[model samples]
Target chain A: MAIRYPNGRSYVGREPNKKPNRQKELTYSNRGMTLEEDLNETNLYYLEKAIAVIHKKPTPVQIVQVDYPKRSAAVIKEAYFKQASTTDYNGVYRGRYIDFEAKETKNKTSFPLSNFHAHQIEHMRQVLKQDGIAFVILRFSLTDEIYLLDALHLLYFYNQKDETRKSIRKSDIEKIGHSIKIGYHPRIDYLHIVDAVYFSDKL
Target chain B: MAIRYPNGRSYVGREPNKKPNRQKELTYSNRGMTLEEDLNETNLYYLEKAIAVIHKKPTPVQIVQVDYPKRSAAVIKEAYFKQASTTDYNGVYRGRYIDFEAKETKNKTSFPLSNFHAHQIEHMRQVLKQDGIAFVILRFSLTDEIYLLDALHLLYFYNQKDETRKSIRKSDIEKIGHSIKIGYHPRIDYLHIVDAVYFSDKL
Candidate 1:
């Protein structure tokens, strides 16, 4: 299986000079719903209900070729991701900067530490320094389980990656990270956790 | 010709009960460098030169599908655009919030007023109300010329759109928009216009 880049064209975080027509390798996906589709629908539901405002950041693409035969629309020919993004989603919720990275794992026992990068961990650290709310949404696709782990917990293991060289056990996630109950409206009820952790303090 | 959607999927700004896996009609695009790429390269150059802190807002996308086969990586299956964004680029420059949009047109006669969206115009209006500097960058790809048009100028014509079904003419852009010179470090020297518009008053 190959990694299917979420974006279109030859995107590699910087200017990519070529058009990659070759289909990249992709592994089998049996999670039923795509991570994006579910989250989008959930956000819409949340927006209608006016619970919170969290949005997935768009991939920074560099458009190289656009053919606009007419004045109505333009199609991209080649583009690349500007650079490795620091985080996936960020927005204002309850007057706090909420940042998060969502990932699904087929493994039933553990989630791999390699799913995250070092720089991403560093970026999360800065957000924490600014008193921002940061967490990672982990899904055990096999068991249909989801957990919201604070960025601090993820950072701890990330820093110890060289020493431990072990994946974060699923049991540890269930014990330490807050479990978010899936709902009909947002699908992932992450704000309940946010309200409990950050807003609760204000009270 | 139809509107060229960047990805193969349909644009889903609003929530849809069900999505069909159908290919959208092909639209023609004049392959050219996007205002984003130039600005990103320019931002990097500026950062390296210690000039300013400007970056394109990451595109917000909703991810729904994920395939984590062996636990090492997760791949996105389906996703959609979150919504119309607020602005293209924003950052701090010389202790001021700088925000603007970047657009390109092959048409040499006039940049169409349709190129600007209603929400974007409203967003800029709000930014200006809050005392943030707001503007748009128009690149005439055919002529390879770019202009930094202030929000005040854009809002003037934007408000007039309902009254006039016509666009702002090239002559008008030339008259009102600030012409930006391309440079090696930052391709588009937009900050120069910022200095002239915002800082010069202090001087």
Candidate 2:
């Protein structure tokens, strides 16, 4: 079966002719999963464990035409992708609203500002102003390193883009952001970082 | 112009030949707007005023085929609607997470359980378990009455569907739910009721 991720990436199963080697297959699958897929698995783990309730919002689409056939499901004939105005993932965590955007960069030195939209940054600002916990999950894919950077630092860097470098240096992220270790059960264990960053006082 | 609401309802503009009277047009427009449209406007109002940051999640779609035409946007050729696993709307309100499903019933006496899905009720349970606020915004279309009923009450009625009636009587909702008054600026001012119900002590 062909499965499509919310980000429009198609999940192609293993080739039918390939020899089923469990060890190699496991490693290949883990390496093949994208940042979004990792987060989706992590969120599912949270949900199943009754820890948190975060979900990646569906990709916004501008549905132009839909055909309804008798006694059958409506088929979308034409549609276009719509830019999202808010962060991708959001939900309740420990009685507080948690919102964040996740982006993976192949760049080793810095994460580019082009990964974010101005409206999304504005949305994060609004979330923070409303006392919601806002942040971004940055993944340096080449090194498999992920960091949870608070929206405060993100907003500051975003505003200084014109004056400063157009991207946030990896060194700066290491200094300010919380490192999240990738785990087996929950691929990206980000909530642990969220706990330390936002609920340290309570802890 | 033809505009489509997230709920799949298409908005047809006034006929070009009709005389446009300001007062009559205003009333006609308001009456024509669905509960979803009213909530969208209300959420936009809240966002603009810095009151809350609520949003309706996009309608989930499963894309089967796409055509990548040269030098233009990718066109979704074939797709089908996917059942939503969560509520229609959610966001931060006064530092707390708020989530809810909205539905309008033409029946004047009761709201049917068929309006909800099992996973949605399960999702609400998870949200409430995380200490987030959950509720349903129900509209009685016949009388144009709106109510914000807490998830506790809704869950109770939903669970009793098999034993008792498959619907919650309007009288019972009036007794348990908070009535939301429709206004000019924000069509349905639900946050005011949320303040009284959830944040009364803080108020």
Candidate 3:
């Protein structure tokens, strides 16, 4: 099957020529789920375990028209998805304000800057300015690898976009980002990495 | 005009028995707008001024049906509002995680406990436990009075429901809550009250 993004990109679950690793795949359940779903499940697990209070903000929608045939339920006859003014997930985590955006790319070599919007970058900068923990969760679906990249590095690369390549190379991400180890109960344990990066004892 | 709450209460703009006081009425411009709208406007003002990064989370909706006749447009045929798992507004302000819900009541004497839900109270408790600043912005629509009551005080009052009344009285709110002065640009300056209550230098 294929997973579709909000921007209308359809992602096939399998690579074009690579054979499925049956033995390794059996270890992880819900490998078919998208990165967003995996993160939501992780957040729910954290919530239930009283570890964090993160939540994904609902997709912003602009209602153009509505039909009220009866008094009880009004139907939205016309609506469009609006460009979000801020990132998706935000909450309080261990006495710190945590804000982040999750994006998945099938490209094995690089994560495109085009995946982010100007407003979202600005919002992340504002969160960082307020001393909140801000970062982006990058998932390379082809390799089934996830990394937590701090917003400061993202802003640095974004500012150099005009003069450099339009994307961050995999090598750069591997050097600067913290790899999130995938787990069974909480699939993407990004918060563990967050603690190491933002709340480490050295700080 | 009638302002309908999510809980199905209707709030009329005018009180029938009271004669309109022209001079006092001219003080407030958007006297007819709902409390939610007023708060939203205030948040925008704060954002533009770069004073705070607060926003009302979008209303969650379960989309049951949709029709996509064209490639560029999608029309929602049926949808229902979902009970939010967290508070309405949340963001980082001055390096602190801020979370709160805004509610209004037409009742002149007290704010009803029924205006809130068990899940919302639970969410607030979790935010507070995590050391995030949590509160409820109460608007007495009939009297045009606004107060910022901390979640600690609210939880105390909520637990004493069996011994006390089912609502928090005006006198009690005035005693425990900080009154928010209305302004032309920001309208309800609730953050000013938040600073006084939670971040006072003397404390």
Candidate 4:
């Protein structure tokens, strides 16, 4: 299946011809779920159980020019981003702040350091200093495999990008990161990992 | 002087013409601080002293289409509102959850009930029921007067909207609502009201 990116470029995922039929669009539907939609569903399930209150931060946009035609609402005619965001989701979960960034890579071998921004690394450092739980949900789109890498692990590899010069190997990630099994109920049962990592020790 | 809305429609603020000139298209000096900017400044000051950790909830928008002009970034081309938000700000303060909505009204005699949506009212109702602090920060633009109206008082008048058939009177707000002194440091000085209303009884 082919997944088209924002740049009109497409990449083949796990099954070459397994693009699920959603209407007439021949887009790759990886079992009818994107990383965001899955996490959103998972968040809802967690919310219902009163496990955590997590919310996806709306993508921040710096609107440059706007045109309001009929006086209802302003329409952004032109805009530019000020900077890349630190994380994708943040919320109060069981009186503790939870912050994380979710990314999916088509590369089956390893996640690339280029997938993250320098500002995100800095932000994660600050979150850590404030005793907030921070992690990255990395999905190998080709294998449909997902892993939760703590900010410390991410920071270690991100810093190594300047020294070792290459990205972290798949073997290293597999060893260090917590593998999250995707399911039909919540899709990505990440809270189980959060429970095992964050809550259990505190309790 | 008329303050032009993005639509070129003019709206009456207290003193749009009072702004001292900076003489630039991109660098027009604002006469007074916006509610959001003031709240952010206030939050920063509070955070520095470990007084409270309050954050303005990011404005919610439904992004429809995006343009990836650069590989490193994505720009929102079109977007809309998903729904009305419940509150303006929420965070933890002294282990208690704080939630509130800030509004400014040009009308001096009374604050129009139209500012509070039905869904927001219901959301506040639930929050108050859950033993959470929910309130509204009202800024009377003409007098530069700000008041912290507790959710109970708001709900009382809101329920009587049909029976009384009138907007909330300024006199009533001044009577029941905790008057918050606007200051340059904290801007709204809302925590003082919070202290007086919620924590004072305990002390």
Per-residue lDDT over A1-203 for candidate 3, one digit per residue giving the tens place of the 0 to 100 score? 67798979798655753544563565443357888899999999999899999999998877777677766776676676678999999999898899999998989999999999999999999898888899999988877888999999999999888756699999999999999988888989998898888889845
Instruction: Give per-residue CA lDDT, model 1, range A1-203, as digits (tens).
Output: 34447674453554452233121112113335766666777766655565544556577555445456575434444444455546776555544556788888889999998888776786576567646677898888766678989999999878778756667999899899988776556667778887887778687
lDDT of 2 by residue, A1-203 (tens): 66898989687666653554554454433367899999999999999999999999999999999999999999999999999999999999999999999999999999999899999999999999999999999999877889999999999999988856699999999999989987889888899998888999998
Each prediction's whole-model lDDT (CA):
0.69, 0.92, 0.86, 0.75
* Per-candidate alpha-carbon RMSD to the true structure: 19.3, 10.1, 10.0, 10.3
Off by over 4 Å in 2: A1-30, B1-30
Highest DockQ: give the candidate number: 2
TM-scores (chain A) of the candidates: 0.79, 0.85, 0.85, 0.80
Q: For candidate 1, what is the DockQ-based docking class? A: incorrect
Per-candidate TM-scores read 0.54, 0.87, 0.85, 0.68
Task: Tell me how each candidate scores on DockQ against the true complex.
Answer: 0.07, 0.70, 0.49, 0.17
Q: What TM-score, to 2 decimals, does candidate 2 have?
A: 0.87
lDDT string for model 3 (B1-203, tens) is 67798989797656753544563566553356788888899988888887888889987877878788866677676776678888899999888899999998989889999888888899999998889999999988767888999999998888777646699998999998988887878889888888887789745
Name the weakest run of 10 consecutive residues (lDDT summed) in model 3 chain A.
A22-31
On residues B65-179, what C-alpha lDDT tens digit does candidate 4 reach at each position?
Answer: 7788756677677766456445767655655667788888889889988888887787577566646678998878767778899999899988888756567899999999988
Least well predicted 10-residue stretch by lDDT in candidate 4 chain A: A20-29
The runs of at least 3 residues in candidate 1 whose Cα sits more than 4 Å from the true structure, single-residue gaps closed, are A1-31, A60-73, A77-83, B1-55, B58-86, B90-115, B119-161, B164-203
State the weakest 10-residue window (summed lDDT) of model 2 chain A: A21-30
Better of 3 and 4 by TM-score: 3
> Which number leads on lDDT?
2
